[model samples]
Target: MIKLLTSADAMLYREIRLEALAAHPEAYSSTLAREQGKPLAWFEERLTTSDVFGAYCAQELVGVAGFRRVDGAKTEHKAVLWGIYVRPQARKSGTGRRLADAVAAHAATRVEQLQLAVVSENEAALRLYAAVGFVEYGREVKALKQDGRYYDEILMALHFGGQGS
Candidate 1:
């Protein structure tokens, strides 16, 4: 099942976030150690956001994605999509697609463009994002650094007028 999350869903959110960080340390720029110190209030606020969505399998949280409404006065119609991650065992099992679909469905209602960045090395994610109608807009060289190594990032966007399914 795919659904919007609430602050009350903190436990599930924390569990899934930890799993993602542990399983794909290279895929995400953030590390579990960094997030462990964050206050619960941070995640609580996220749970209450109008744009956060989650995907579950038999009631187990399997994936999560969120679209943050643009803050600039002139960019309200756009939203930056982020925090997209799926459990290792859940990859390619439709969990990622369902999570993305839920976000896209909500974006269709308010956003003109949905933008996100993916590490250049994550081919599976790139393919999945493309399958969902996101097209690469540009690439940033040495956009991310971790453990003394830098990684490129690909910026992608899905316009509301394009096919997304």
Candidate 2:
């Protein structure tokens, strides 16, 4: 099952987030070193402020994806998708697709475009986003640096016309 997470699920959310950061440091902008010390309240605040969706198997939280609308009036028609992660055991089971669909469906109602960034070397993620109708618009060189190495990112966006214009 996939659903929008609430503040009550903060602890679980933090656990999965830290797991993602640790398991795939190259895929995210945030470092585990920076987030490891954050309190549960920080996760709760995130849940309250953003649209984060959690994927569950039976009772275990196995995946997560988040969407946030741009703040400025001029950018209110756009929203960014972030933090898409699924446990290794949960991969190839459609969990990621379901989470992506949920976020896109929700975003289509609130924004004219949904955007996201994926590491250039992450082929699986690029394919996933492409399957969801996101097209590459540009690339950012050295978008993230970790352990003395720099990584590029592909910026992708899906335009939803006539829905939230």
Candidate 3:
């Protein structure tokens, strides 16, 4: 099952987030070293502020995705999709797709466009976003640097028909 996560699910969310960071450090902007020191209350605040969704298997959170609308008036029509991850055991089980679908559905209701960035070498993630109707709009060189190596990122976006559509 997939559903929006609340502050009550903070501990589970934190666990999965740390796992994602550790398991695939190249895929995310945040480092495990930085997040490890954060308090549980920080995670709870994140859950309360962002439109975070989780995929659960019999009460265990296995996947997560976050959506957040831009803050400024000029950018309010845009939203960002981020922190998408599914457990290795949960991959190929449609958990990622379901979590993404939930985020997209929610974004379509609130913004005219949904945007995300994927590491250029992550073919699986690129394919998944493409399958969800996100089209590549640009690429950023050296978007992330880890362990003395640089990784580029592909920027993608999906446009919804605006507020009334």
Task: Estimate TM-scores for all models.
Answer: 0.91, 0.97, 0.97
**Which RMSD does model 3 reach against the true structure?**
1.7
Off by over 4 Å in 2: 162-165
Pairs of residues at least 3 apart in sequence or in different chains that clash in candidate 3: none
| Model 2 lDDT, residue 27, Cα | 91
lDDT of 1 by residue, 1-165 (tens): 888889988878877877777777766778989877778877787677746788888888888998888888887877887889987778779888888878887888887888888999989889989999999999999887877888899999888964342
Alpha-carbon lDDT, every model: 0.83, 0.96, 0.94
Candidate that beats the other on TM-score, 1 or 2, i.e. the better one:
2
- Against the true structure, what is every candidate's RMSD? 2.8, 1.5, 1.7
After superposing candidate 1, which stretches have Cα over 4 Å from the reference?
A: 161-165
lDDT per residue (tens digit) for residues 126-165 in model 2: 9999999999999999999989999999999999986543
Error of 1 at 162 (Å): 11
